[model samples]
Target: MDPEPRSAKGRRTRARLVEAGKTVFERDGFLQARITDIATEANVSHGSFYHYFDSKESLFREIAEEVEVRLVSMDDIAQDLTESAGPVDRIRAANKAYLAAYRKEAKIMRVIEEVSRYDDEVRKVRSKRDDYLAARLESAIKRLQADGLADQRIDERYAATALGGMVAKFAEMMFIGGARFDMNTAVEQLTYLWANALGLVPTADQKVPAKSATA
Candidate 1:
């Protein structure tokens, strides 16, 4: 059944709540965040918060939904792929887009990661997102193999899992392990790794330059 329609003001208030929820969750994290904190952050009353959300968990799920959608929006991915010239280019584009989104939503992602240890519902949400990204990478790997652009001996699914885990963990380490991450360098190296793992040749544009004799 279709859900009941909310008035314009109701929609605006819910948006404010969501924005405030993200801020509160990012600052305080899931374990430390409270309904009152989100309500205060939104400048809305406690009753209003309850009216829109049954509990903090529901609100967080909503935020997670938004984050996942942004992270792997097929429309955005298609645009990125469309502009790419080859497998290496496509991989680089995907990495750049994922990294950009991860940087922006790092805090919330950390919250989700931490809370998922004991929260089954949250863990499921996280797992679903991971699965979606992995599947996309797996498909890309298969395509490369089909075109004779990648190593036929590589197991597409396992390779996809490894690549996805490496990128996700790298981003996490940068945020929580105090690693100094240079975005451009990280993306370049990651692209190189992906290309090498698939046994694909780098494009001429990606080739390393030889030192000049004068030097």
Candidate 2:
């Protein structure tokens, strides 16, 4: 295993390698990506690759971890679903942030999904990451119920998991499946579906926000 970098420049170089690894892995895949290629892409010495990561797979793991972090770092949407914001605004904010983040990392995410199919380590990382999202969504659903926005009888866990699945699949279909998708439409429709499914009744104005109907 590689030792931790103790200097600022060292840390920067290591981060560059990780960034390059994402590009190389997405372009060449996990099986075909090489340390030399990553080094070349990062404009660092080939030996420097080993200074931070023990192997290509280790680098891949780090990249996968980064992707996982991006997937759930919904700081823009905030987690207080029961905040003073109305259900419609909250739904729009969360859906918009999630879709935007997914679009930004779509390529690397596709690579992660593909490699996870046959790599146990990658699969575990992906599974854990997704479970975290689902758990958060489940909590949010419960909050909605408490706020009287969602049906009290709805099974939060299953509903959250199913909704999470639908969103992920829709993103993959649009971004990874090479389909021409309108992001505005996706966010609006998806937000509507989620809000309605949770039993939230939209007010006349909230039923279709201005931006929601544009696309």
Candidate 3:
């Protein structure tokens, strides 16, 4: 059956709710946020919240999915890395993007981390994210090595897997552990390892620089 005309409005309302929910989740966190708060923030009837989402946790899953999407879309970072810069620069830019996203959304991100502890659904979301990111890193690593920017000495698969793990750990420490993880430190650390691992230019001590972007 053709859907009601209100279906479009429903979709719009749902999108607005998700967007508002993201801000609220980012502000107060998913564990702490309430349906009333989201409804109030969305300026919708409290009952309407349920009409759109089964529960607050389901709403959070929607938000988490969007966040995952935003992370992967990152046109500026991916383009600057892939289209504008060489393979080594691509790695550095990608690292900076991960850290920047983590820093900007630390609270909502903490919610994801916390929820993953006991919730299988949240864990699945996280697992999917990790797998997608790992595949991307693996492909990029292979591409770089094949293109001669990376060192053939290192196993392409191993380097990609190791690099992906390092980036994930770096985000955790930097955003969650409150470490002194700045762009410079990220670049210096990754660039050094990447250059050596890939047998690229700049030898030792040369760090890859990324063009600055707004947070």
Winner by TM-score: 2
What lDDT does model 3 reach? Answer: 0.73
RMSD of each: 4.3, 2.8, 4.5
Instruction: Please give, for residues 111-173, the per-residue lDDT of candidate 1 as tens digits.
Output: 877878888887788788889989988998999999999999999999999999898888778
Q: Model 1: runs farther than 4 Å from truth?
A: 1-5, 74-84, 209-215
Q: Order of candidates by TM-score, top first? A: 2, 1, 3
Question: What's model 3's lDDT at 177?
Answer: 72
Q: Give the best candidate by lDDT.
A: 2
**Whole-model alpha-carbon lDDT for candidate 2:** 0.84
Candidate 3 minimal-lDDT segment of 10 residues: 206-215
lDDT of 3 by residue, 1-215 (tens): 11122677887778778877887887787678888889889989888887788888888887787776666555668555435466556666777777777777777787778778988888888878877887877787678767767667777667767777787777777777777655666766776676666677873444455644422
| lDDT of model number 1 | 0.82
- Ordered by lDDT, highest first, the candidates read 2, 1, 3
> Which prediction has more favorable TM-score, 1 or 2?
2
TM value for model 1: 0.88
Distance from true position, residue 171, model 3, in Å? 1.7
Candidate with better lDDT, 1 vs 3: 1
